[model samples]
Target: MRSIQALPEFHVFFNDHVVNNFNTLFISMPSSKEYYATGVSGSVHNRLFPKASFDFIHTSYSLQWLSKLLKELVDKQSLAWNKGKVSYPNSAKEVVEAYKMHFGKDIEWFFNARALEIVSLEILWFFLIPSVADSHCKCVIIAVFDLLGSALMELAVQGLVDEDKVDNCNLSIPDEIASLIESNNGDFI
Candidate 1:
């Protein structure tokens, strides 16, 4: 639980889409901020830094975004075509499995890039809300996503948005990331 305060000197980097205002982020800095701040632009799935550039890396409420939408989900001919759904709560087995498979790759991209970027034997801390296998929580979450789908359907009915577009969209429900880590044959673990 030791913080950067323990270090006499440390650097902090902020990363997000290229469209984010880096000036605003730097301007809203803490009064006691002692570390250097650098803003990195682009997807985390790609390499953003040189090897051994950092000793510690951390991810917060990000990482939910897949590197890209699964081609199968977007293709009409694919069995994984998630039709008319914003979330996978009520999706078919094929659709759900497709999402899980895609997430595995997306997460691997994130980890693989970090593995190359971070210093050897250092910590790579990340945070993500994975879909729990619990029953009550599952039911509640299913209801919520179903409601969201219904809302999008209403928008489509009103002609505010294209129905086909809504059908093409799919919200992420990441499977157990711990399992992904366990299955890794890499040296990071």
Candidate 2:
């Protein structure tokens, strides 16, 4: 909040969902900063402010979540169905593609919505996790979802957990910065 207040004559509007602790946010504001502040409760995927209302938008570790899961992944008959898995494994080519497509659509929607609310050439900052570098110059990360799914499956096999619960679990991976920039024609950056 202080960082935003540093910009001369800038008013900071912090957005969060209804479940957020807005009181704490308001209470924490230092009396020294003269800038005005407001809390908006809503999803960034949709417009929260009027047209050309903001000069800067900042998001951290939030854009990775897709608006919804890929339809094909949930459809049992679809080729992208991810049976027995909560997320795409490195070997699951089709699952990876499905996630990528879903991410692309989500990003496009986010930018389109933001385009209506933000002024042209206004700054947008998104802090995201980068892919892990591997020995073969490839990007890889320890599959936390795979571990979680495996644990759930083990419990189901032992009759300690419901198979249906395990079947319903799914996770989304964050897009690489390059893909995000490319998806929107590098306009948002």
Highest-lDDT candidate: 1
Q: Note each model's CA RMSD in angstroms.
A: 4.2, 5.4
Best by TM-score: 1
Question: Whole-model lDDT for model 2 versus the true structure?
Answer: 0.71
What is candidate 2's lDDT per residue for 44-63, written digit by digit as tens?
A: 77778898877787878767
* Tens digit per residue, CA lDDT, model 1, 1-189: 866565567688899989999999888999685678899998887889998888889988577777777888888898888887887746677887887888788888888889888887468887866564432456655677778888999999999989998987787767568788788855432
- How much lDDT does each candidate structure score? 0.78, 0.71
Q: Which residue runs of candidate 2 sit more than 4 Å off their true CA positions? A: 1-39, 89-91, 120-122, 132-141
| Residue-level error in angstroms, candidate 1, position 4 | 15
